[model samples]
Target chain A: MNKRELAKRVAEKCGQSQVVSTLVINTFISCILESLEAGEKITIQDFGTLSVKQQKKRERFNLATNKVETYLPYDYIKFTASKSVKIKQKEKSVKKE
Target chain B: MNKRELAKRVAEKCGQSQVVSTLVINTFISCILESLEAGEKITIQDFGTLSVKQQKKRERFNLATNKVETYLPYDYIKFTASKSVKIKQKEKSVKKE
Candidate 1:
């Protein structure tokens, strides 16, 4: 599913127009990005937490090139799903199995 | 930050009422949860992808009791940030350094 499909579903469920849903989605994304860029975390109930973790600069060997290179440290996003989500997902998968 | 803070920022930026913004945010989260429950991946542009990964059941030894236990399989959510987000985060960290 992409943004358009998600927006459609949200609009239907929220009884709102797709245009407004799309705008809200955009705003939501923008807010997350801004917060992460500012080194902050966003915690949404029953969803997950979005945060950035800074990795240390390290040397890694390139398998294809057979050379060692120093990679600069960068921040990466980490998301941990809520316990309720985890339980639900596990239940579904177990039923499928 | 929490959901309320996020909704406040989004409402301010989108010039929408807090009630509407909160609704949108809730809908956004619900949409994601529903998609994941249905085993679908959501890809938001310039944000990241949300998907579920199932792990196989395995046996592990308990550290404290030293007893072997079988752990049930579970599904987990994974998120990977966009290249633009990575670059921006790196730049900010470099400036701080």
Candidate 2:
């Protein structure tokens, strides 16, 4: 399902209009991205944990060039699904402090 | 940040009460988890794309046991960040079909 369909579901569950649901979801997305970009870890209850991991600079052989290439460090997204994930868990939301 | 803190930020941004905001955010999380569990790919505009990827069975050498172990296939979550992820882009919501 896409965002619109997801928004509709959320709106129905929360008894809110789609517009408002979408707005709140948008804000949430922004917050998550901002937090992750700052190298912060976020753990939601039913959902898994999300964090940014960095890779160290490494050297690899370039087959095409037949030369050793050094790759600079980079950041990537990592998600760990909650071990307790279940249909029943859907009612439960993000993990709390 | 934890869920409560995230909810507070979302509430402030959407001008919704903390209760309503939390409810909406919870619903959204549930929807996302359900979709992902069902092997659906979800892409939010400013955020990123999420999908379930299957890992093929593989063999790995166990140094402790000094033996080769076979691993079964499994599904894992994958998130790909958007190309246009920016602070300003947060204003935009999920990607549209």
Candidate 3:
């Protein structure tokens, strides 16, 4: 589902106005963005974990030109779903099959 | 940050009561869970995308016993952060260095 649909559902489930729900959802998104930007990880239990994983700097050679280049180290966010969620996902596939 | 802390921040940012915010947060979690359970993907733009990725079934060998075992195909959720967030994270690293 997309953000609008998801926001609508959240508003209904929480009995909040859509406008307010939109703000809350956006705030939550910004909060996560800020956290990751500050080098902190956000862990919402049973949902999943969002954290930045480090990528090492290294040198790579171009196969075609036979030239070497250096790459800088960086970090990227990684998400790992909880085991319960994983099981639920698998159960759906099993039922379909 | 953990759930409680994140919830508090969300509540403050949205100017919602903590009790209600908790419900909203939990509901959002359940919404995502239900979506994935039904084999649907949840895409929250700017923050990241959450979707199920498939893994192919394969056979693996036990190095010690030399016994082969079959593994069933399955799906798992994956998250990809937005480019803006990636840039923000990198900025923090640059500042620290």
Structure candidate 3, residue pairs in collision: none
Number of the top-ranking candidate, with lDDT as the measure: 1
Expressed as tens digits, the lDDT of each residue in A1-96 for candidate 3 is 988899899999878888877777888888887887787888899888888777777899989889998788788888887676654464445533
Instruction: Order the candidates by DockQ, highest first.
Output: 1, 3, 2
TM-score of chain B of 2: 0.82
lDDT of 3 by residue, B1-97 (tens): 9988988999998898788678777888888777877778787888777877777778999898899987887888878776656534654555334
Chain B TM-score against the true chain B, each candidate: 0.83, 0.82, 0.80
For candidate 3, the docking band is medium
What does the lDDT read for residue A11 in candidate 2?
A: 99
* C-alpha DockQ for predicted model 2: 0.34
Which ten-residue region of model 3 chain A has the weakest summed lDDT?
A: A87-96
Summarize candidate 1's per-residue lDDT along A34-88 as a digit string, tens digits: 8888878889888889888878888999999999998877778999987766535
Residues A1-97 of candidate 2 have per-residue lDDT tens digits of 7788899999998799999899999889888888886768889886778877766678999999999998865566677777776422222232333
Per model, the share of native interface contacts recovered reads 0.67, 0.58, 0.61
lDDT score at residue A56, model 1, on the 0-100 scale: 85
Quantify all predictions' global Cα lDDT against the true fold. 0.84, 0.78, 0.79
